[model samples]
Each structure stands twice: as structure tokens, then as C-alpha cells.
Target chain A: SQTIHQWPATLVQPVGSPLSLECTVEGTSNPNLYWYRQAAGRGLQLLFYSVGIGQISSEVPQNLSASRPQDRQFILSSKKLLLSDSGFYLCAWRTSGNTGELFFGEGSRLTVL
Target chain B: AQSVAQPEDQVNVAEGNPLTVKCTYSVSGNPYLFWYVQYPNRGLQFLLKYITGDNLVKGSYGFEAEFNKSQTSFHLKKPSALVSDSALYFCAVRDPRNKLSFGAGTTVTVRA
Candidate 1:
């Protein structure tokens, strides 16, 4: 079975502070990883996706960035956080050749003050 | 552009009644539709998907969705609603690159 893990579970950050959220997948290799953010009562916005290590495609231009340092490790980072950056950040993975069904992690809640 | 549209923002249903959450989509190529559920402050969970073959697809938690190509809709349905079924539901369309475009989401509230 494949499992996705995301951490910090929850965080409170001050404005202009750095942000780092990590996600990892176990029992699968070379899977597609994605980063999504959901604001209160809004749809999820795709932030970044990676096909392989060191390859990332950004969907929205914002105060966030993503990196695939390893085959199953993906990290979402920001040099300086903004108040608008506060939301529920989710990390999901999908099999390379499979359909669009995504396996998601528990998610990280970030409150930027 | 590939996109998904969940028309209702919220749906209220009584327990033991049939529940339906509407979803429609627009995509260039063959559409791959999917449904996901999200609890409060939790990540989305895959409920069902419609890739091909049967128009009626059964998925986790006794939930099902009917894909209508002519209507461009894939509506999630349940024979009997439960209080536990209250949550956020999302519709998605997959692009050729395997990226999923999600809808705004519909909140389902099953009253006891």
C-alpha cells in the first residue's frame, strides 16, 4: 500500500517569516507529486507539480515555491510569508501511468499572522 | 482549458433520504472525471472516478456517480444519506498531462 505523509500538521508563522512544508511518499517510486492550497470556503489552487527530481511546474504565481529533492520527497517553501499565504496546504501523489486519482496526505494548516 | 464546475455551493439533505450532488465539466479531449470528499480541515479523499466503460461507477463508502457524456455531467449519488456524509465534495477533470483541475466544491449537510 502507498502512503503519503505531510508534516508540521499545523503551524503559526509571523509575517515575512520563512515557511517550509514537507511531503513524502512511501511504497512508490517516481510518482507525480503536487502541491495545492485551499482557502476558507474556496476551491483548491494548484501551486506546483513535479514529474521527477529537480523538475517542477508552477501553476500559480505567488509567495510559494516547490522542490523535488528526491524521488518521493517534495517540499513547499517560501522565503517570506504573507498574510494571504495562510491556508490549508495539501500534498498529493499519483501513480505515473495511472489515471487522475490522487492519493493525499493529512495536510498542513498554516496560520500567518 | 480543462475545468470542472460544481453548481451548488451547499446541499442540505435529511438522513435516510437520497442525496445528489451535481457536477459538470469541460475538457478538450476525453474527460476523466473524479469525485473527492473532504472533512473539516482534512485532506481530500478519492471517492470515485469515471474513466471509461460503465456510466455508473461505484466507489468508496457506498457512494456512486453517474457519468453522462451528453450532459457533460457526473453527479454523485447515494441511496440513503447519513449524517456522516456531511462534508465537502469536489469534482475534478484531468488534463492530458495528468494534472487535475478542481471545482469550487460543494458542501453537503445531512441532517439527522
Candidate 2:
């Protein structure tokens, strides 16, 4: 079975601080990885998605960026955090096909102050 | 240009009663619909998906969704609602490139 792991489970960051959130999938190779953010009272928004290593498609233009260092390792990063950046970030993976089903990780809660 | 609409922001249902959360979608080509559940502070969980074949698709946790192509709607339904079912439900539509466009989400509150 494939499992997605994301950390740190929760984080408190100051304004203008750097941010880094890591996601890794075990038991699957060359999977499609995605980064989504859920704001208060809102649905999940796709931030970035990668079909392969070093290839990322960004959905929204924001302070956040994503990178796929390895086949199953994805990272979301920001050089400087903003108050609006605070939200629940989720990492998801799906098989490399047209299937729309995605498996999500536990999620990471970031509180920017 | 794929979009999903969850008309209701919140739904209140009594336990043991039948529950329904409405969802409608718009897509240029064939629509691929899906339902997901999110608990407080937790990630979204895939409940069901409607790719093809059966209009009535059954999924995790005894939840089911009916895909009405004529109506352009895929509504999530449960015969018996439980208190544990209280959470946020999201409707998503898949684009040609396989990217998912999500709706605003509907919060379901099952009262005891």
C-alpha cells in the first residue's frame, strides 16, 4: 500500500520568515504529486502539481513555490511568509494516469503571525 | 473551463435520517466527478468518484453519489445519517489534463 507523509504536523512562523514543508510518498514511484491549501471556510485550492521530477505546474500565483526533488519527494517552500499564507496544507498523490482519485497525507497546519 | 458548484454552504440533518448534499458541475468534455470528506484539521479523504458506467457509485463509509448527466449534478447521499458524518464535504470536477477543480465545500452537521 502507498502512504503519503507530510511534516511538520503543525508550525508557527513569524512574518517574513522562510517556510518549508516536505511531502514524500512510499511504495509508489513516478506518482503525480500535488500541493493544496485549504483556508478557513474555503475548499482546497490547488497550488502546485508535478508529473515528474523537476517539473511543476503552478495553479495560483502566490508567495509559495513547490519542487519535486525526487520521484516521490515533493517540497513546498516560500522565501518570505505572509499572514495570508496561514492555512492547512495538504499533500496528495495519485497514479500516473487520467484517474482522478487522490490519496492525501495527514496535512500540515501553518500559522503565520 | 471545468467548475464545480456545491449550492449549499451548510446542511443540518438529524441522525438516522436520510441526508443529501447537492453538487453540480460544468465541463467542456465528459465530466469526471468526485466527492471528498474533510474532518476538522484533517486532510480531505476521497469518498467516491464517478468516472463512467454506473450512475450510482458507492464509496467509503457507506456513502454514495448519484451522477445525473442530464441534470449535470452529482449528489452525495446516505440512507442513514450519523453524528460522525458531520464534516465538510467537497465536490470536484476533473479537467482534461486530470487537474481537479473544487467547489466551495458544504458543511454537513448531523445532529444527535
Candidate 3:
């Protein structure tokens, strides 16, 4: 059984501080990884996705960036965070060549104070 | 490009009653539809998907969805709603470009 892990479970940081959120998957290799953000407890917005190491695709232009340093390890980072950058960040994975069902992690809630 | 639309923002249902969350979608090719549930402060959980044959697809937690190609709709349904069923439901369509587009999501409240 494959499982995804994300942390820190919750964070509170001041504006302009650097941010880092990590995600990792076990029991699977070369799986597709994705980052999504949910704001105001409503809609979800795609942030980034990676098919392989050192490959990242941005869905929207924003203050955040993602990187795949190692297979099954993805990190979301920002040099300087803004107040608008606070939200619930989710990490998900799906097998390559599959239809489109994704397994999601518990998620990281960031509050930019 | 593929996109999904969840018409209702919220749905209120009594426990043990039928529950339905409406969704519609648009895609250039055959649509791949899916349903996901999210509890407060938790990540989205895959509930069901419609990739092929059957118009009705059953999934985890006794939840199912009906894929109506004619109407371009895939609605999530449950015969008996439980108080635990109260959560956020999302409808999604797979983009041919190897991504997925999610709807605005519907908040289901099952009152006991």
C-alpha cells in the first residue's frame, strides 16, 4: 500500500518569511506528484506538478514554487511569503498512465500572520 | 482542456435520506470524471471515478456517481446519508494534457 506524507501539519509565520513544505511517498516509485491549495475552505487551485525529478510544471503564476529533489520527494518553497500565500496545501500522487484518481496527504495548513 | 462545474455551493440533507451533489463537465474527448470528499482541515479523498463503460460507478464509503454523457453530468449519490457524510465534495475532470481540473466543491451537511 502506498502512502503520502506532508508536514508540518500546521504552521504560523509572519509575512516575508521563507517557507518550505515537504511531501514524500512510500511504496511507489516514479509516480506523478502534485501540489494544490484550497483557500477560504472552498475551491482548489493547482500549484505545481512533477512527473519526474527536476521537472516541475506551474499551473498558475504565483509567489510559490515547487521542486522534486529526489524521486518520491517534493518540496514547495517560497523566498518571501506574502499574506495572500496562506492556505491549506495538499500533496497528491497518482500512478503514471492512470485515468486521474489521486491519493492525497493529510495536508499542511499555513497561516501567514 | 477539461473542466468541471458543481452547481450547488452547499447541500443540506437529513440523516438516512438520499443525498446528491450535482456536477457538469466539458472536455474535447471522452471525459474521465471523479468524485472526492474532504473533511474539515483534511485533504481530499478519492471517492469514485467514471472512466469507461458503466454509466453508474460505485466507490468507497457507499458512494456512487452516475455519468450522463448526454447531459455532460456526473452526479454523486448515496442511498442513505450518514451524519459522517457531512463534508466537502468535489467533482473533477481529467484534462487530456495530463492534469485534472476540479470544480468549486459542494459542502454537504447531513443533519441527524
Considering every candidate listed, which one attains the maximal DockQ? Answer: 3
DockQ of each: 0.87, 0.82, 0.87
lDDT by residue (B73-99, candidate 1, tens digit) is: 999999999999999999999988789
lDDT of model number 2: 0.94
Would you list the clashing residue pairs of candidate 2? none
Q: Write the per-residue lDDT of candidate 2 for residues B29-83, one digit (tens) a residue.
A: 7889999999888888999999989999999999999999999999999999999
By DockQ, the better pick of 2 and 3 is: 3
For model 3 the local lDDT of residue B22 reads: 100
User: A-chain TM-score per prediction?
Assistant: 0.98, 0.97, 0.98
**lDDT for each residue of candidate 3 in A1-113, tens digit (9 for 90 to 100):** 99999999999999999999999999999999999999999998989999999999999999999999999999999999999999999999999988879999999999998
Off by over 4 Å in 2: none
Tell me the lDDT of model 2 at B93. Answer: 91
User: After best superposition, candidate 1 residue B84: deviation in angstroms?
Assistant: 0.3
Tell me the deviation in Å of residue B57 in model 3: 0.4
**Ten contiguous residues minimizing lDDT sum, candidate 1 chain B:** B92-101
Off by over 4 Å in 3: none
Q: What is the lDDT of residue A46 in candidate 3?
A: 89
